[model samples]
Target: MSEAAIVIEHVARRFGALEAVRGATLTVERGEIFGLVGPDGAGKTTLMRMLAGVLRPDSGRITLEGIDVAADPERAKTALGYMPQRFGLYEDLTVDENAFFYGELFDVPRAEYRERVTRLLGAAGLAAFGRRLAGQLSGGMKQKLGLVCALIHTPKVLLLDEPTTGVDPVSRRDFWALLYQLREQGVTIVMSTAYMDEAQRCSRLALLHAGEVRECATPAALKRRLPGALLAIAGSDPRAIRDALADAPGVQGTLLMGDRVHVRVDDGGLRGPELEARLAERALAHAPFETVEPGIEDVFVALVGGAA
Candidate 1:
């Protein structure tokens, strides 16, 4: 494994009566995408802000590329780019103008700025929109522009807070493509997002809730942490099937997904038949049931539900 580009150690932050981050700790390996997955009020933003040196943690330590962030914020920030949920962009300025402004702040030479900006804009699909005012772009385009601005300085690590929250699906897809490209270029990315599917794209993720770290692992590894086998049943009425399995023997939990009901069985071999018998008793005998792989959302619900 590569050296960790970012290290967080038992970090805690509080705001008056609220403990926003409680003993949160994780590491982001060099050149990998690490995701902070959680729901609102889960402290994702607070944690990211602390990492970026914008907000200091009341306890614990944060280090970027081995430099202590709290002890030396300026040195730590030089090697990283922090993009908050609402990136501060001059709505009145054109996209290119905004990029240039950031470039100037980072002190990139005029010639170097021109070369990097041209490539970055073209790669981000914002080359044509360079002349468009920042406020005129759609939600996705605005995000892409924010990303371009954040990358203008070419920092070693990038921290983004919910970059795709309100973006359209297609735009979200485009944004992720840009991230992958950056990863390929050896940029370490640490991002926070509420989207479970988006979490799947991360190389590794830390699942958080109520300011606590529930679990941290690769998406596949996290799914494997699920207690038992997952079984999906599709019936004439998926909701009926879900209800039928709600408290069925050997059924750990049940979730409704599209036209199917996914039930976590304590034992695939032993509980599979029991589930069928229970469904039969409930007049759902004809429902189709098969053991299936658990998705990240399933594992998240299982872990968080159990914690709750």
Candidate 2:
């Protein structure tokens, strides 16, 4: 068996004049949960679509296991299951019907789909809702059903695009539990998410920005790679605090985390006084700058462009 589950070599895709993906290349190992982390327009969806064989790259090559996606999508899809951001679940159909629909699409035998859907629905906590209309289900429940449908054929690789977005905290927790279970079963998973916390759950991550992969590594490694030291300053208005330190020398970037503002500096101890001095001019009442651990969001904002 090959060590890699998915591989792409300088893949490029475009829609008219818009370059959705630009020379993006990454690899996902068998049984690993790889995350694509980036903001909107970062090309996460485009890259995912290419990997799932829904769209072909205009240039370069992409292979699922050993099968080229562009050259032979049908053969590649036999081992791939894709759940787009808005999974095409028939609103009027029951959960069972939806799963059956996907099963038939994948050409799974009726007897096989029956057992598989039963187990999947139960594992996703949707056993009792099998007869419930998809339109009536909660947002999280719908997402779970979509996942169940995606797994109807038990594909070797699963690609989920922001599956947990807008879900309640408890539901999100439940969804992640499901992902952990899939990982244990040795199912290779690649997903894109806007949530930083979700990105941390992956085995490794590829940070995309402006249709390019800026960085790729484990969560801990990405945080450790954050240049300079991070410091937090508590303030009544995080935006104001960020603005006040905007022109502070030696500061690399500033990010707001709730009521606190995180600023990266060449030297925290030396720059602390300067940050204070700058804020003092604006009469902004802010707590002392204290060293803080860097978060994945911080690394992303530092490497890719995001709102201050």
Task: Please provide, for model 1 over 1-308, each residue's C-alpha lDDT reduced to its tens digit, 9 standing for 90 to 100.
Answer: 34999989999999999999999889889999999988789999999999999999999999899889999999887899889999999999999999999999888889899999999999989999889999999999999999999999899999999999899999999999999999999999999998888999999999998999999999989987999889988888888878777877877888877888888888989988888888788787455678888888788878888411
Encode model 2's per-residue lDDT on 1-308: one tens digit a residue: 87899998999999999998999888899999999999899999999999999898999999897999999999999998899999999999998889888999999997787789889999999999988899999999999999998988888999999999899989999999999999999899999999998999999999999899999999999999988999999988889999888668998898889999989888988998888888898899988778989889999988775537
True-structure RMSD, every candidate:
2.1, 1.2
Runs off by more than 4 Å, candidate 1: 284-286, 306-308
Shift of residue 215 alpha carbon in model 2, Å: 0.6
- Find the 10 residues in a row with the least total lDDT in model 2: 299-308
The global C-alpha lDDT for each of the candidates, from Candidate 1 onward, is 0.90, 0.91
Measured against the true structure, the TM-scores of the candidates, in listed sequence, are: 0.93, 0.97
Shift of residue 112 alpha carbon in model 2, Å:
2.1
Cα distance off (Å), candidate 1, residue 33:
0.5
